[model samples]
Target: MSVLFDRIALIGIGLIGSSLAHDIRRLGLTKEIVVATRSADTLKRAEELGLGDRYTTSSAEAVKHADLIIVSVPVGASESVAKEIAGNLQPGAIVTDVGSTKASVIAQMQPHMPENVHFIPGHPLAGTEKSGPDAGFPGLFEGRWCIFTPVAETDETALKRLRGFWEALGSKVDEMDAEHHDKVLAIVSHLPHIIAYNIVGTADDLETVTESEVIKYSASGFRDFTRLAASDPTMWRDVCLHNRDAILEMLARFSEDLAYLQRAIRWGEGDKIFELFTRTRAIRRSIVQAGQDVDAPDFGRPHPLDKK
Candidate 1:
């Protein structure tokens, strides 16, 4: 494919940023990639990895002369990055982000964005539990969703160009208003990570029950939650804070459902328990049908015994 932009500035060289760099280079998405990060070590590491054509610790310097800018910082740092890069942004540059919390990102970064640039808030529903520049790989966005919550004053041509960029990365792009996007992600993404972290924390506190036993018999069920629990704490912390209201709403709903399950089990309501399980199992099948996950057993985890 032809280059989508003359220059693409990546304002944070974390997993998402590095992955974009890999794909942008592999797919020929841009003529140049300027990587930036707040941490000098991270900037140095990005340079060593050859993730971009240029690297700097200054976000403002990274945006200079860029045609497209992608901010991949924590949601809480959105405004800080925006403030730093505001004045240096080139006219008509398409600026977007890969933050999970759309509403908070918009609230933080939108006001600081210059009127001449196109600021589109976005969330790429793609990533693994891994973090850092080394964890990134090509094809991470393949078969995944990239949702955009465009503002009212957004330019149509700019939005289309941004959509085309994601499409070239193998992402299935979708658009929704910021409020609705936050609500949807609260239930689908935030709550699951919250639950995972909580479950792991509870297990840690169960010393009377024996932590050693929990680790020894992890194959029972507890092992699955650890993967989600192992996600970067900083990112999750920012997600909880930035998307608090929607997350709280989802948590309340989950609490009610848990209570209903507790009452059913206490009263030996086997039929009710079976019904809920049956209904929820269908959702898993639907996700696989939609190509979001594999149909293979153990969620397609590689085992030593599997044939190559």
Candidate 2:
């Protein structure tokens, strides 16, 4: 493929950022990939891994003269990154992010973005529980969704360019309003992770269930929750804080549904339990059929160390 940009600045050296670096290099997406992160150690590691052509601890310096800038930091830190890079953005540059919470990211970064740059809020529905540069690999976003929540004043040419970029990375692109994106993610993504964390915590707190027993028997459904709960704590904490309202709304509904299940169990309503289970099982099948997930018995996941 032809080079999409002259210079691509990656303003975070974590999983998403490194993955993009790998894909960009693999696909020859840019002439130069400048990697930036606040941590000296991470920047060094990124250099050691050869994820980019240049490495720097200064986000502003990294973004200077870049044709495209991708901010892959936590949602809570979006504002700070925006402030640091605002004045350094080149004219007509395309700036985008891979934050999970769309509305919060827009609220934090949009104000600081220069009028000359195209600031499009985005969320790539792709990742594993693992993080860091080592956890990233090529083809991570293959066949996955990358949703853009473009602002009202977004430039059409810029939006299409960004869409073409993601498409080149093998992602299916979609567009929606920021508010709707947040609410949809709250139910589909955030709630599941929250439930996983809660279930894992509950298991840990079970006084009668020994830790050894839990580990030995975790090959069941509990293991799945553990994977989700094992995701980066800082990222999840920021996600919870940034998308509070939508998450709380989803949690309220989840609690009410849980109560209904509890009542069904207490009343020995087999039909009610079976009906709900049957309907919910279809959702998983649909996901597989839609090519969003695999139908493998192991959930198509590799060991943590194997991700690299």
For candidate 1, write residues 1-308 as lDDT tens digits.
89989999999888899999999999999999999998999888998999999988899999999999999998999999999999999999999999999989999999999899999999999999999999899998987899999999999999999999999999999999999999999999999999999999999998588989999999888999999999989999999999999999999999999999999999999999999999999999998998778899898778887766
In the range 1-308, model 2's lDDT, one tens digit per residue, is: 98999999999989999999999999999999999999999999999999999999999999999999999998999999999999999999999999999999999999999888999989999999999989899999988999999999999999999999999999999999999999999999999999999998988989899988999999877997998899989999999999999999999999999999999999999999999999999998998898777898687667777777
The worst-scoring run of ten residues by lDDT in candidate 1 lies at 299-308
Per-candidate TM equals 0.97, 0.96
lDDT, each prediction: 0.94, 0.94
Q: Give lDDT for model 1.
A: 0.94
Number of the top candidate by TM-score? 1
